[model samples]
Target: MSSPVLKPAAELASTNRTRHPNESADYRRARQALLVEEIELRRQIERVAELRRALPEGGEVTKAYVFEGERGQAAFAELFGDRQTLVVYSYMFGAQREQPCPMCTSFMSTWEAKLPDIEQRVAFAFVARSPIARLIAAKKARGWTRHKIYSDTAGDYTRDYVSAVDADMPGYSVFTKRGGRIRHFWSGEMGMDTADPGQDPRGAPDMDPLWTILDTTPEGRGNDWYPKLGY
Candidate 1:
């Protein structure tokens, strides 16, 4: 009349399943080594974050540069337009480049969709080291009319923010303002770590939640992804 006792998982293991003896010991050792390496990499990332948090306050802003905006043109101070902080993403699209950088294009595609929410928290804009007319023309061709765009043709602003190295290197930077003085805060020169090869030189920090959400789907953001302007 007593209830049957439950067996342990080990006892339920299938005895009939065949085991391959051809698997080399070196292969098993290599797999374990990779696992150990991954753990160490994660620790290194945490250390980098600690150092970032300890960084001292940056230099004060001294110069204002001109940039073209959605409503014609504006200056660096005007772009902030009264906001306490500004997040400028230095897009790689330029007058000389025939096509937009795929990695930057992907990030912008994600950022554009959440512009309304981002605008409420901080002033956001995209800057490029290209002529205003060129930037405008590219924006229209790509259909990114809603998101604010700007041109850093002279490279002064880009160099000041460390977003541009000379006339070739491309990057992004963020700034904060206090008592009428602006200071550099952060930046994203590298694309996301998971980004495809031949896209961007920098790797993106794992902060955005959009990637995780997209990972749940079967197609997984699909391989042939490309940014569509209006559609």
Candidate 2:
């Protein structure tokens, strides 16, 4: 079925702008052009989301994965609770690392205040290779209260969904339960292997708000600096 027609982005941009008094005609023209592109970008994001939601039924999750969680030992399906959809994030803490990954920590810090709102729509949790106690300590150090966490103690879930060979990397995955059966819905696949030339690997529609905020500034996200767990 065809989607409804929409107004052209350029028309929308041109019709709704309020100008800065100091701006010149040349600046106005450039700003108007950029606004048009911004409108188009917003539309493209919606289109991509539609495509993602329209994907065919994903593979069934038959493996019996378990984790050490707040409720002690819980099976994979238990993570969903009453919600049909579950969003799991792989945290970059492992038995071999002295500290959790700063980049992952930074990404997660933004999620602190947003977790309550997010959980209203879908079940959410963080899974890591570190023992549950260590992960809880890290969360306490960060001063977060609402994050649901789990340890992939056997690494079975991480190996199948996040990495092979049990690499300490972050992953985003969604699963859905329907008619008493759970299935993998989606997981981010972009990474270093698929990085574009002259750019560090990152997910499109970047999930990290820090980079999103930095991108709006004149300096942008520079090459040298990265977030650290401590100052």
Candidate 3:
């Protein structure tokens, strides 16, 4: 199906109805230019999403990975339950660390409230290298009731999907189940090597809203600041 032809971004922006009392003409002119760019940015975002959806089938998941969670031991496929799609978040809460990575925790805190909305379309799970009890304690501390966390006891899944050596880091991976086969779908690949100058490595359309909110502010996610477990 073809989409209806739309007016050019500049044309649409020029028709913007926003008006602030006592606004200067110079400000209005600059805001109109910014609106045109914002319209183009929206189109670029949709274009990238279309490209992602058109990707070829990803590799099949063959390993018989096992994980232990609150309910007990469950095989990899069991994580999906009934959903055809699964979303997994690998957090930085390995055995070496007494506490979870503050950034990962921050991301999870944002997601904690969003799982219900997300799960309507995909199964979601949180995985870590720490024992199930530790993960549960952290969840309790964070007051998360719905984030289903699992422990990668043998590190098999972590080694393959998260890190080659099972290094403690954060990750987001998606898997799909269909025709009795599960295959890796997508995951954030951008990292330190992919980072732009004077910026931290981050995913396209970053998964954390904290950064998104910060990006709109004048301070603009200052390089020296990071979220601590506490103030």
Candidate 2 deviant stretches above 4 angstroms: none
- Clashes (N, CA, C under 3 Å) per candidate: 5, 0, 0
lDDT of 3 by residue, 112-172 (tens): 7788899888999999999999999999998999999999999999999989988999889
TM for candidate 2 is 0.97
Question: lDDT of model 2 at residue 8?
Answer: 97
lDDT of 1 by residue, 47-147 (tens): 68777666687777778788766577687877776688898877776666876676566667676568888788789878887777777777776677557
The sequence of per-residue lDDT tens digits that candidate 2 reaches over residues 51-93 is 9999999999999999999669999999998999999999899
TM-scores of the models, in the given order? 0.62, 0.97, 0.97
lDDT of each: 0.67, 0.93, 0.93
- Residue 215 deviation, candidate 2, in Å? 1.0
Q: Candidate 2 — worst ten consecutive residues by lDDT sum?
A: 10-19
